[model samples]
Target: MSTIYKSEAGASEIQRRYREALRAWPVPAEHIHVPTRQGETFVIASGPEQAPPVLLLHGSGANATMWRNDVTTWSRHFRVYAVDLIGEPGLSAPSRPPLDSDAYALWLDDVLEALAITSAPIVGISLGGWMALDYATRRPDRVTRLALMCPGGVGRTKSAWLFKAVLLRLFGRRGIRRSARSVAGLEKLQDQSVLDDLVLTFTQFKPRPAQLPRFSGDALRRLTLPMQVTVGDRDALFDSADTAQRIRQCVPHATVRLLPGVGHSIFDQTDSILAFLRA
Candidate 1:
């Protein structure tokens, strides 16, 4: 849990690179401040506005920057809109306590309604996947298809990384460093390029940490589309085999696969995801 300051060379570099990356991305990205009952969410839209829109969601402690690399791939076939979950640590506003599934769903629906995007594929990573499924189930008419990357709330307690990150946020500034490398799930994010993406997520949204209620499975029986579920073979929080089995029980034809040695960052599998979306 190393604390990084603005005076730190690496921290400053991450900030410079983030601004440059946003400026030089392949497609046009406009930030949307969509308001909801609780607060407003910052969503980034890439590709053509008229193209079929696809929503991308990031995991906890991360932001829309998680899907930066993938936006280039998804833009060719569909308009890509990646969101910083309202209460996430990215560019979105924070919510007070009393977080709930219905609140999450309502906030998400508000974003879509404001954007006038009624139906399109939703690609969610970790918590994003959890929200996608919850939104689809609650208002089935809004989501066209569900493509979850090792979705959350599948009855896994370890799905949350906040427990381990607490010490970092509290003592990171004093050089109480943990192997930032072994922050648990992210693999090789210390590399320069990967580090840039992670840094953007960290700086863009300074999350106000709060406990998320354990995700419920009330929508399991409500799935109604060509669902695709993929997880990493070594995912610490996601049980790939069990997750696939559960998804199968709901949508029999749901295609599921395990990416070996990749852990829970399934959205990092750009080629695999692009192919899945194209199919």
Candidate 2:
């Protein structure tokens, strides 16, 4: 088995499921695998060939499949590139460089170059949001806009979930299901299939072990592009309030939204995010 998966058979199952998801992709798409210094990076491209390019970066432990619900709507107006982040449970390479280093940014540089994108808007969630921020801060000129959801780094990442997850793991599948629901805020998830998929994927996938490296106030201040951030007030993974406050303080011009009674997962914001990207 690849180091990222628990077993070889499990890896095959994940890949098979991923391929099935791609086959059922809501809209027509072109799957492109770009070679980077890290390794091969998988990307799903959809929508008008000449339309404005918009990048979609999924959170850790996820792949391009996470955007299946949102892509059809977003692609109507933009050429969407849903990238399978390297080292995740996707078709991408399992080359997880240190999160604290500039390697990720450099890897992205290679990706954008391979895709022939000069600059474009980026939408990211969770760990992906942290990556978008990292890249934007390091190379602000390349990002036209940013729309982030429950991004890490800016907020104080909470450890409560870790303890809960560890304790829950002892109970096997039932415990894992409950833990996944808690971490993903599955209570709000409207799609049953997504829940099932999440449970199945995590059962075999081993997520990155390192904590996301936090971005400094100075780094956030470098984001002069149009930006939008949304987080759930009841987020179990990070201090959403701190995330809001930090963005307000550091990126004063950026728009921020804190949803009440929500959790780590924010869903069904297709229109709002698209509006922000289009604006």
Candidate 3:
């Protein structure tokens, strides 16, 4: 059942109906106030508790709902936990002690610990992916398997668009709605409604993490855990093959896949993600 007991859709809407919208949705979620330091709350949603645990993290400027379209399908086989990154929009709170990239990784680790997710499969996309890799490098024992989708921090990313976001955020949160509209209406974004819904709910974003630092390439090599990496062929970030190679050099045992015509957003490559995780 969704922690969100009430909905604008209708209070009388059967639990199943809301679940239908939220259950197999692109951005299906509810408002949960999970406790953190200083009585703060963090919002998160998931597929089911009975399945194998898989925590889903979104990229910067995105939220857990980005996985809504993919979660139900993936959750059928693995328990999927989509988190509203604390210090971000959605139901999370106490967006304080502003951080850098490594700090972001520690914050994630702290959230999982608070959630009691001691050890589990973690799949991160973009910044989330970078966090996952950084976490694994820092404490490989805590993660069983790792999956990174067009993760950031591999090298200089070609995100001239992100600069627009920086400028708009400085202007104020109101600009985000317009930004969200622009993001949702893009031709590549087929599920405009899902992205639209996500953009509408981005109440706050964590203060920016610091510029990319030289992360622990040596630490990443020592982990023997299975790894899978993917990026879109047309991704604006890194060119496909080089994207995989750079990550592969960090962990030679990793398997890398490229999606033709796909971009940086792994949520866009829903089917392939489900297939790889299920395998």
Candidate 4:
């Protein structure tokens, strides 16, 4: 299988930083590696063993540590499993699976089976959100509740905006920071260290070029599990208003929120997400 990093040295450096970030996780957690056909999936488990489970999936180019700020609060109420998606710049396998197929769904099934989780609530951001939705659609009985943060595949993504993002990538660090700020609609990033790490990963890692596969209206309509969808009004990737509207129209029982003055990044909604999960 092809690797995602440009070079072995670059991959090592990124892995080193990933380890450093994991070490600095605010809450105590256990790192476990589970074998699967995709590869060895890495998971950070925390909270009580007897507590209800909450599965977390991070966006593209990020590992489980992407939930660093939110994990502490979530661990207080439920057992949290922050999974590093396979083929990303985490401790997981470097096997890149085709996004258009049911590969991700199958891979997730293996991970969940390895963990012995029959059913659980899932929270995901961006690309991770797409994965959660894909899995839920494929195996509805396995997912109890679903929360998506600025998730892709629900609405149309503008090609012009994607071109602009590609242009921003050419100018290096300042361009990256500017692009991030533009996406979040925030003057300052919530975590600069995380941003710095992302920049490094971008330079060193070879992320998949394929855009997330859009879910059809019929697919959304088929979701029977309780669902919550939140997106920033200013999201540069997808049309946020359209996203919320589609969720409401297709998934009639879904709770949808469009945050004003926000952008593609919706990490700040951790508390509301916790409330939604508990409710």
Write model 1 residue lDDT over 102-171, tens digit each, in one string.
Answer: 7777787788888899877788877788788777777888887778887876635453444555555566
Candidate 2 vs candidate 3, lDDT winner: 2
lDDT of each: 0.68, 0.92, 0.61, 0.86
Best by lDDT: 2
Tens digits of per-residue lDDT, candidate 4, 183-245, equal: 444455766776777677767788678888999989999999989999989888788898998
Give each prediction's root-mean-square deviation over alpha carbons: 4.8, 1.0, 7.0, 1.8
Give the per-residue Cα lDDT of candidate 1 at 32. Answer: 83
Candidate 1 segments exceeding 4 Å error: 1-21, 96-99, 159-179, 188-190, 196-218
Q: Count clashing residue pairs per candidate.
A: 7, 0, 2, 0
Would you list the rank order by lDDT, best first?
2, 4, 1, 3
Candidate 3 differs from the real structure by a C-alpha RMSD in angstroms, to one decimal, of: 7.0
- Model 3 residue 107 lDDT score: 70
Please give the lDDT score at residue 273 for candidate 1: 70
lDDT of 2 by residue, 178-243 (tens): 888998888767677777778887788989888898899888887899999999998989999999
Ranking by TM-score: 2, 4, 1, 3
Instruction: Please tell me which predicted candidate would have the highest TM-score against the true structure.
Output: 2
Q: What lDDT score is found at residue 213 in candidate 3? A: 46
